[model samples]
Target: MCYSSNGQFLTQIPTWLIVVAGWFVVHHLSQKRDQRKEARERVDQLVTAILSIEERAVRFHQSDSYQGDVARSLLFDIQRIIAKLKRHPFGSFVISPTLLKELRRAVTLKNFDASKFTRQEANSAILSNIADAVDDIEDQLEQEYERIYLSTEWFVVPSQQKNCR
Candidate 1:
């Protein structure tokens, strides 16, 4: 009777342990998946903002009125991005110091040499720097996306599947 009771207790312990462990694993996986989804959505929005900033910078560079409403609009976009980052919990998808500095310099150059730079030179210099900053940020975001989504993939077919199909 004692041996039987001990065996029953051992079985119950494994059953309870399995239930708890399974719950923990599922909860952890769910949290990770949710975090990835949030990050992906945030990055997508950030990419759109970066593209808009690049477009606005190009237009500002080409236009005669860098101090006018158009320039203000471009500056507003940058400020908007900064504001968004302030409230974000997981941090920015990607915003490098170099990119930030280049963006600031481009804006400053546009303001200082607005009347000096020909449209073409402004396009080549200020607009090009804006585009480069956008590209760098996007590259960083892409790396993050790949790290999260592409870390694992099947290397070979299973034996049964290989045999059958």
Candidate 2:
């Protein structure tokens, strides 16, 4: 209860109650903002990893020395990344089963023995598959990123609309 000037009665909320309510609202908003930031960071890390794979694939494809060890190492790195992405909480949401299947298919170098195939065949086939897989992953990531970050829109409340009109 509150009394204004001239002892007029005024309905007043307790200051402590108002403060608590404000705190809750602020805390909720802060949590949501933090979640969004973390999600964006995860997306960025995934994108970086994919880009690194692409760069490495391109370099290996162009290099004249088509070492089996290097190819095996690259494949292992890609598989490891894919496994990590699959295990990641955010990654599981963003990466689909179909995409994972496609990645696995692309990463598998069929009959790829460095000694058996000429340099050109190895480069064009195996490296190209890796490149294609990376491209697909990047495209999917971009779509997910846009859906999460760019598609949200705020709408005006009814009272605010009335005021605007």
Candidate 3:
């Protein structure tokens, strides 16, 4: 009778342990999933900010009324985004050095005096140069996004791989 009770108690202990362990594993995975979701949302916000900057730049360039304040504001917004990304937890891993360089080049318009130029000057080389820089930045951002978020290789764990020996 004593042996039977001990056997039952031992079995119950392992069953309880397995249940607790499974709960912990699930909890850990849920936390990791939530963190990834948050990171993706943050990246999306940064991408949106960059797109807004690009649109405003193109609009300001094409407009007849060139307000220096508006131009400066856009420049400030770009700089702010860059600074924020640099300070982000995943910024160093996700944002390539090339993207940062391109962003810096784009903001070189601090001394841009669009008011001095005639309407014909709107289509000048400076405008094209800014457009090119914006294009390059966009390309770099896409590559980084793909590498960090879209690629399955990035999320794969060696231990979890089916082919692992």
List model 3 lDDT by residue over 1-165, tens digit each.
355576787878888999999999898667656756776777677778877876676666666776678777887887787787765434534555666666546544433476463332556655666667666666665665445545465445322432332
User: Which prediction has the highest lDDT against the true structure?
Assistant: 1
lDDT of each: 0.63, 0.61, 0.63
Error in Å for residue 17 of model 2 = 4.0
The best candidate in terms of TM-score:
1
RMSD of 3: 5.5
Order of quality (TM-score): 1, 3, 2
The weakest ten consecutive residues by lDDT in model 3 span 156-165
Clashing pairs in 2: none
Local accuracy of candidate 1 as per-residue lDDT tens digits, 23-135: 99798667756766776788788889878887777766776544566666776777777667555532523446666667656665554455564554553766677777778
- Model with the higher TM-score, candidate 2 or 3: 3
TM-scores, all candidates, are: 0.70, 0.65, 0.70
What value does the lDDT take at residue 42 in candidate 2?
Answer: 80
Model 1 has an lDDT value of 0.63
